[model samples]
Target chain A: MAAPESGDGNNGAARMVTLISSDNTRFEVEAAAASLSQTLQLTILDGGGGGGDGIPLPNVDSATLSKVLEYCIKHAPAAANGGAPNATAVDRAELERFDNEFVNIDQSVLYSLIMAAHNLEIEGLQSLVAKKVADMIKGKSPMEIRRTLGFPDPTPEEQAEMNAHMLEYGWAYE
Target chain B: MAELLRQEAVEKVAEIEAQDSEGVHQEDRLSELPDDILMCILDRLAVLRDVARTSVLSKRWRHVVGLLTEITLSAADFESPVNGSKPTFDVVVQSNMDMVKAVTSILAHTSRRTIELLSLRFYLRDESIDIFRSVDHTMQNREVVKASFAVFPEMRDMVCTDDDMVIYGRRFLSFFYNYPRVFGGLKFLYISCVRLGKFDIANIFSTSIELEYLCLNNCDCGIRSLLQIEHPQLMGLKIICCAFEKVELNWLPKLQLWTYDSWMNSEDRYPLSFGYVPQPCNLRLINTGTTLHKTIKLSDFLDNAIIRQLNLDFQSGSVGDLKTRK
Candidate 1:
């Protein structure tokens, strides 16, 4: 098991691990960054993704794996500090800017990232994507949310069910 | 054999192309996400009403709205004549009933989980006693960490009226006395325009151990006895337009801010006194009457207390005597 090191100073010399996507693409990342994913953290601690053996994520495609890694690497330092009390305003602002731009992608890509984040159990990434989807759905009606998410037109039965539900909780619509 | 393989590959490509054209692969991804992720999305909605509205999205969402941990029920949400007209007495009564029904319905349907925060704001009338009882019933079994109960009459200014004020005050005290368990485990409490006597206040302090912030606005219960607030965990206290004879701050070590706003006709000679507030505190006094006797000095009120900031805004002529105490 790769035990967590002591002391607060996170300088260069951090351990690295290799992650393999479903497409068999291998990418090397800092162990600390990849450990943001709770699922990978345990495996990495078990010395599974150390040296020759790479962690295989069969559910994540190459394109989605890269994006997930991008978020983890950026958030790794702040997360390492345990919400670093000494973190300056500029550092937090820069991270906020990165997060805002990170989720800007096509709808299909967003869904792919959501799936990967959920599967990986990355807390920050899951919340970020969820918040983005919530923003898209806020103040939108049921049909609008479906349309925004690229859902096909509901069948007549589904439409009737939705209408009945809406009528029941009509005050919520108001 | 090579020709046959090429033909099969071409047919597969055409099938993929046809599926792409139809967009069938883009199935409701939002609903397809796991329950926990959808819950995360639902939790981000600021208002619980919006969260409830999501139930109509699909059959899967019908029960997800029940997962919200915070519920805020406001009487205004049920107000009729939605176009900003004055609500009649009948309308107000109807809205109060509807508000109670809505809260009960939501609580009944929601998953049995500890609510993080539950706020109820409504007008207190004789008819609303049942509503309060229903609310108490709903809250008794659940764990509510922070709760606020605000009762205001239909007319905003009617809070200061004597008869109406006393009626509301009596109701408020009786409700707390009857069902103290409904307000248990609250960290933040704000009561406005409710009458409270010494025992009522004592009951509140004794029941709510985790109380951090308490605001009593325009309450008429402190007229007879000295308002003694002796809470160990209370951090901030605001008393506005209350007719208290004297407010004695007793054993509140964590209190940081104290604001007392009095009416112009208030005759209480010493409105406030600090006994054991050790924290650096800011005391703000606004619109205090100008009836200080000639022998009383402003410094006498200070009593050599260590206050970080003291802001005294008195009636016009009252400043003449205070100028010498600087």
Candidate 2:
């Protein structure tokens, strides 16, 4: 595939890519934003997601894909600047606010986002979701953690196993 | 056509949900995640106790904890409560031993994993535990890329005697000698409230080949003994309230930032002499000592090295007649 012309336009006419979600939804976004995904970056760099042929992601549903793209589009500029060493405090603070708000979602959506971020190999998104999950698990006991993660009621066998594990490793809770 | 497409998509989602309902525990989404993803979640639980507490969550979580790549254990996490009173010496030693036991067990649990970061912060009071040996065992050939240690004494700096300094220094050196590979691969080292000999500090530089940052606080070699430092990879150095005659920066090619907070000497010339620092652009010199009555000329203090940023703070004393020549 022929690469796009260098510096095609001065009016910020960036190249675009289309991604097809598992639910057959089309998302047209800037190529730089889509490249935040290490998985998509190689494909896009090889001129794979150009023009009408969209990159099909079978693992990510349309909702989760939309959320992941929102994060990528917000963070692509900073990522392009090599972590934006020169980024103003105001700009960095704005992005931090966006990230804190973006991961504030329902439990099911959070899990889906985690899986999507992992499948796409998006480093920033992956860490963000992981940090959120970790915070939920921090300072929580075993039962609290189970409830926080929406784990179903334990069966008698599982309860016995949990009891045995707790009795065995009880020193950590101190 | 779009309406028909939406209908089919809704039906497919409903079908999947129906199939998931037939499973025994499909709602446990986290348990359903792959092992690597769970490890990522647990890795952010920086405190070792929190990471360990995840073991009782489920069998999958216990397995994931075994596969964690980063592990941080600190004695402060297990500090015994003193109820607003100063802790007894016995209490401190007991807590340190408790932490040591926990660290030993956890290190054994995750011995098989290829740990990328292993950090430890502990008081140098329990010599019987041999934390150095346990850490060396866990880190050997495991490709541990970054390791840091913050060693502290049980006594405060003001109360520490020369004998205490020598004892701590000896223990630290012996540990260093015993675990050469561990020291060689260390990325950061912070030692406080200990007196290191001139040769001991020199040996650290030679052995800790990969150390990029070092902080020495309330420590010294001897009374006004000249300390010469040379490191090929160290980028940042901080000497806070350290008692040294003159710290000579003999050769640090990659040094970028240096901070010397306080010294005891009242010499007319600057206590720090830069020899071959080529990359440093930021220099901070702070002192609250009465030795600041003397004048300091930046041109002579900098010794021909180009600096872009300089900060001088002499709290409660006048840094008399400061001069900076181009």
Most accurate candidate by lDDT:
2
DockQ of each model vs. true complex:
0.21, 0.23
Give the CAPRI rating of model 1: incorrect
- Candidate with maximal TM-score: 1
Per-residue CA lDDT of candidate 1, range B142-193, in tens? 6666776666665664435767677777877777677776656556666666
What is the lDDT of every predicted structure here?
Answer: 0.71, 0.77
TM-scores of the candidates are: 0.75, 0.72
- CA displacement after TM-score superposition, residue B291 of candidate 1 (Å): 3.7
Instruction: Supply the TM-score for candidate 1.
Output: 0.75
TM-score of chain B of each: 0.77, 0.83
